[model samples]
Target: MTPMIEIDEVTKYFGTKLVLDRVSLTVNRHEVVCLIGASGSGKSTLLRCVNRLVAHDYGTIRLDGVPVDDPRFGKTGLQKRAGIVFQSYNLFPHMTVLENITLAPRRVHGVSRAEATARAQEVLARFGMDGFAQAYPEQLSGGQQQRVAIARALMTKPDVLLLDEITAALDPELVGEVLAIIRGLKDAGMTMMIVTHEMGFARDCADRVAFLSDGMILEEGPPDRIFGAPEQPRTRAFLDRIIASGRL
Candidate 1:
């Protein structure tokens, strides 16, 4: 079967600095792959490349069987299929939750306002934000805003979701709520690629775990092996640091 996402020998650079170097990975349908590494490890950059939010300097990224950069995808098409949610909730401060969620479907996909709103309402209810449809971003807590952002991404019914340190901005007490939403998504078989610093969450939710260091994928395997018995010394060192910081 064709993989839902395929990154092959991809490389990226920011000016003279290389952010990703010959990285390769794949995520099959209904599978969740967690990317764990320290800051500046290129995990977020790699996720962005998959959706063309950031372009790779070399190699290919494919969605299903088609190259992400193919003209057929256009910018909107690719994004419609591969939705992304960031650490910071990017909702428009002026828009209500319902409006924020339905904006893309109504504007980019050309769905009628009524239909877009109906879909947004359904997604919001699923994410436990049904009562907040009229609430502005500032009116909700950090977790609520992030849930709205995830709901917005799902409004288009994306085939694959990319999450970049989604719980990073939340208060410690609020992190579980956001992570619970992800657990529900995993139970529902949503295909996902997540860049996160939450090692325990990664171990529990990921079908596979990848360890990236200095722009390279040094090790990847089932979460048990990657978290329990990583092969690379670099991978071991990283995990040790996480354990030292009491984060693993």
Candidate 2:
């Protein structure tokens, strides 16, 4: 598979506090790579840096072999190519589901409302959300809202998708439904880089799994290797803790 996203010796700092320390990784086209670690391990920060939501302090991030900071891909251009969905669902409470999904294309990409609405309806129906186009965020369940968020991200037809703990805020029963959507995306050949605490989902769905410690990748391999026989002591310890907590 061709490399879709690449990070080489990337570093990030938050007010002098080092968040990422020369981290490097690669995500291939039509692949799902999961970043797994405890909170504050820089998984989320790394995902943000990919789309320039949080600029890296050093090193480089390239999308499809082009530097992310290249002037050709202006801020909106980069975002349009790399759609992101966060844990909070980030929907506009004031807007209906259709409105929220169509906002970016209509406003930022110069898509007409009629065209955007038609596209939104098609995507929503694909996600089984066609019935809720007129509903507000608060009117939907957590799972439904999250599905809407994913649908909204898909509106831009991104080249790669970044998911940051997308199931972290859901109820246990609702988690599966959201994860199911990701599984569907994977089946349809959507390239995704995911930051997640859901170890089982990562193990089952990801083509590769990367374990991050502090701000660096400690061990990375197929799920069978990482979950079944991690070579690094730190990775073993982290998995042990997750197992003890009954989270893995």
Candidate 3:
């Protein structure tokens, strides 16, 4: 099977500080990959580069059997082909949840308002936020807002989605709701790349886990190997500290 997303010897830098160093990986269609690492370990940066949000200084990214460097692969390709859910719920405060989703489909895809609204309604229903369509961002809890963000991304019907520490900002009670939404997506076979600290979720959801540190992937394998039987000393030590600190 062809990989849905591929990263080859990718490197990125900020001035003299190298953030990602010759990192590479492949995510197959209908597969979920969970990326875990310390803060500033380039997990999020790597995801951003895949969709051309960061624009890597070296290496290449391919999406859906097409090289990302092709000039034809511009914002339209990035927006429609690859969806991204941010750590923060970047919803528009003024727009209602319904409008938040319809805006993209209308403007980007040129779908009629009625058609977009119909699609938005279906996805929001699936996301369990159907009734909240008319509600403004401020009217919803952080979890609700995040779900709306996810729904909006899915509204475009992307082939692959990137999630960046999506539950880090929510209250513990709220976190479950957001995670449940993601779990639903995983079960529904959305190809996903997740940078997450939620180990249990990763263990349960990911087909594979990549352990990143110092701008490189230290190890990667099925969750059983990475989470239950880590090979690298660094990976084991990191997991130990995380567990000891009561974060996992």
Q: Which residue pairs collide in model 1, if any?
A: none
Q: Compared with the true structure, what per-residue lDDT tens digits does model 2 show for residues 47-113? A: 9999999999999999999999999997599999999999999999999999999999998999999
For each candidate, what TM-score against the reference?
Answer: 0.98, 0.99, 0.97
Residue 114, candidate 3: how far off, in angstroms? 1.3
Ranking by TM-score: 2, 1, 3
As a whole number from 0 to 100, the lDDT of residue 58 in candidate 1 is 98
Model 2 weakest lDDT span, ten residues long: 69-78
- Candidate 3 lDDT, 171-244, residue by residue in tens: 88898898888888889999999999998889888999999999999999999889888989999999999899
lDDT of 1 by residue, 17-38 (tens): 9999999998999999999998
Between candidates 2 and 3, the lDDT winner: 2
Global CA lDDT of candidate 2, please?
A: 0.96
Candidate 3 at 215: error in angstroms?
A: 1.0
